[model samples]
Target: MEIVTTIRREVLTLPAAHLGPDNPLPPLRPLDETHRVEDRDKEDLPRDMARQIDYAPLHSLLPVRVRDGYDRRREPRPIDTLVIENDRLRVTVLPGLGGRIGSLVHRPTGRELLYRNPVFQPANFALNGAWFSGGIEWNIGATGHTALSCSPVHAARVPAPDGGRMLRLWEWERLRDLPFQVDLWLPEGSDFLYVGVRIRNPHEKPVPTYWWSNIAVPEDCRVLAPAEEAWQFGYERRLRRVPVPVHDGTDRTYPRNSTYAADYFYEVPERRRRWIAALDADGRGLVQTSTDELGGRKLFVWGRGPGGRRWQEWLTEPGTGGYCEIQAGLARTQLEHVRLEAGGEVSWMEAYGPFDARPDGEWTGVLRAAEDRLEAVLPRADVDAARTAWQPYADTEPGERLATGSGWGALEVLRAGWKLPGTPFDESTLGEEQQPWLHLLRAGSLPEPPDSRPPGGTLVARHWRDQLETAPATPLTEYHLGVAQWHAGDRAQAVRSWERGLRHAPVRWPVLRCLAVADQEARHPERAAERYAQAFDDLGRVRREAGDDDGSWTAVTAALGREAVEALLAVGRTGDARSVWQRLDPATRERGRFRLIEAGLLLAEGRREEARAVFDAGFEVADLREGDEVIGRLWGALTDEPLPEHHDFRMRPTP
Candidate 1:
């Protein structure tokens, strides 16, 4: 089949006569095709949003020529080199400058290109650097000044004693070359870059070194990765950190959005390699992975700033510049060393492509299979424990402060909202946060709830109250009673129950969360903020003492804090919101998605077009597919839409 693709600068279009090894430039081999279509609206999006949507096509781009050259002049004045050719592409070699390519020149198959390469300045960091060689202007001195110099490092391959062998290929050349050539074939309009490093251990005493690529991804893009869990440890102390409970007692009002700063550094115990995907402005997404040579580098799915929430968790932008990096020769800054042999070599491998929803399953499937295979080969004790820790619970005692319920186990009776058996979330009250379920009860508004009088309502209430009244009461039981009353629509009564519960158990995060959520929904965000702040502080203390590493819970607490703060903002509590955000770690504050969503909410409340812009911006930063579980969650919060289908909302096993 004929492949229609964009040739940015056809790497090789030389006649068959130029195919020999003696040729100075290597023939471009077949790289993958670009699948994007110019128009997407005409495409039929899958009815199932969970289904990956394929909106465009990818045209395979290939390399047609290959060549290599070395500077022949001797070392008295360390040799520097330049290439001048009328061919499809040109190459220049600068020795000892650093691990980076000294110079490169690419000329379109039929055009004369005379573009100069951008200079590299350390102060002005750059994610990538490139040059156009054929028809562009030339000035070596100027190029040197502008071009950033990578640290001088030795590569595996060094020039031969004789000049015939023009280039010294690094051991990792085989791995890097293919992807490098492939990236050049990316469709127009999408922005991407590939950087390769050659780590050469010159000393007999091997010392561990870390390699990092500061990929300059688009400012507004979402990142996707499949990891067991994420960390919330902040690199800096002042940076906001999530406050998860190390032992017990967490607030209920905290919102639980996925993305945050605080430096998420994760290591997959079962699998060494990981992959990350990102969607750009044009609805295009890319997936990148680490190669075996790197022996499975830990995946770092990170982006920071108040705008960070939008970029890392679920944001999406097809044409933006977010990137997935493959660092082969290093480990995280403070981890164990990967000892290399005397003649050792370290290489990293990764792959990326446009974000097509349909292909995502296949792409993710491959990673899972690979991870499974790795796990099978390398049995890890930590992996099992981590999995166990993340497992969902099946049942809790009557008075237990339930973090989550199975299906609608807790909401079997709908005093004011409709419930499908076993599903506690309301069919009619779909778009509100979990806090609203309890708030509705406290407000004495159960008349409209479906199944409000489920058979065991009175018994359950009595059971909860009994637990709360027990001497040395379980704060958990009181917390649940407060929830039940709130749902019963007796706002004052619910508060009384919570206040009583707090008196019995003040440090319970759930109690604080429930009360704060109630207050916020009741239009008193200031009071809610205070409670949330206190709950978070207490929770943070627990995490620090226990040395908790997982950030999911901390993220959950932060979400609650943000929710109350956002609510306060809505009620003209800008000062309160500002104060809450100010206390947040710089990373949390910089989460773009959360900020944009907050801004969107503010705009929506104000009835402005900026709300739409904020929504679009939020979408760009979200890692959403056509259909995702989160879509249901968002719909429930944004609109009073019922779930399209019912799944047991039961708080069964998490897996």
Candidate 2:
């Protein structure tokens, strides 16, 4: 018998590129000027002191390159792909496109464990704008698809510690200035692929980060996991935790026949081990497992209704089938819950493999069989203990409630063959899945709204005003109206609109944020500080109410607090800034960006030596070659000697 492990590179040509002038990519906004507000204070200080003060540009912290629409083409291009294979499995990775797993197949049956898109389709679905729907996307840095998702990453083939071959993909996360690496290893004679991940914050200041492994599979697949409860955003945009598998009289484990779409974030139970699987009717599927570090799982399903079908077709090539996502996150939910201290790093390992079931066995049986096989190959300590702990839950009777929390109890109900509540036109009534196209068409008979008037500055604003006047009173519409008013230079009206929206919907974070921005722009520092504080408080309540005790609210609260501190500083209220800074949680204060503010506060307090020390420590971890001019200014202040503006202070440049 022989064992083989090889990796090779190839260029994949996608079929007839969807090229047309109508398919334009979204534009990237310029960096915000307010981010450099601290620099404006330089003029107020004495010449010697001003020259000594360091003013770090926002770019130093977030060195993101925004590619314009012109840089993107919908035409054919030779995409670089990495193919790694062994005796049992083959995995293809697209190093240039987010280092996504383009394909994962079981060799013996030629069964694809992941959904592969025939074309490289980019759509404006991500928070940073461009997103593609297929395979496995490694999300890092701040949430969504991450800024690196549409860009190429560093790739190399290296020897693993165990003397096995490994393919490593890495990149510097622009927003947080953090470095992340993913290693894929296929051990000899093993049927599973081992993925090792590491994220490091080498900078002197702490940074908030997020990580999620989004795996796409065929639509309508049954998902099996041990989560007790799931959190979802309701119609009002509030996060709420509900029973898993079945929530609010609906089955969420699989795609529903309704018109509504569902997106769930599951809170995995506290355990030493965890696993989630998506199986087809034949009980053949993919299983993802990891030890305690990775705990959150998410599911997103697009219904087969008219709007859902339209979005599906618009997002991908016409002939390609629809798919859903099974995501695994490092924290309870998202990066908002994770904070990495300066020079800190976190690492974890996960395994993916295929499993089969006997003709007479259920999906659970297949999962157990796979678990048994994994126990034999992987490290045994934690896995064995977890299996022993989970035996009672697995063996519980159908519909029997367990003493565990809502999340675990829900999983037990799912294990008992619970069916989704039936609808009026369900398969039972129609003898097949019934299409609601006619009903939908009638309901959506209203004509589309006309385009806004030509952009003469105020024209767009007037359009939004008209929308606010006639449209239903919703937080989203009011927020848009406030935005348009602000853009039209009607700051007072924008503030009023935002405040009204806030009063009506206190949970709307964006409205509060917009109000704060309006106040700041209008030079009302006190009002801005108040609004920012309110927003922070609202975020905390939302997270706590949704049971997100794991710091999933980190990003929002951090942003609000930072803005409050800046607003206070802008008004020369150093004492107030210090007070707000002190009130911030340790995790938020530990971030590298916050450390800069702390150093500034110390400088304001005339603690020159302490401030200098802080700056010196920051330089040790910061990358000088990345054009960190601020550090140079700080060093000059401490030494009383002017340093070159663009000198490389590091001993060696980053590779």
State every prediction's TM-score relative to the real structure: 0.27, 0.52
lDDT for each residue of candidate 1 in 258-343, tens digit (9 for 90 to 100): 23222333333444445444434342334444443433222222333233332322222223333222222233311223344443
Per-model clash counts, in order, read: 120, 7
Candidate 2, superposed: residue stretches over 4 Å from native: 1-3, 16-62, 65-75, 234-236, 357-655
Residue-wise C-alpha lDDT for candidate 2, range 19-68, written one tens digit per residue:
21211111112332221214444455434323322322222111232321
Off by over 4 Å in 1: 1-198, 237-261, 269-273, 281-283, 295-329, 332-337, 352-355, 358-655
lDDT of each: 0.32, 0.57
lDDT, candidate 2, equals 0.57
Best by TM-score: 2
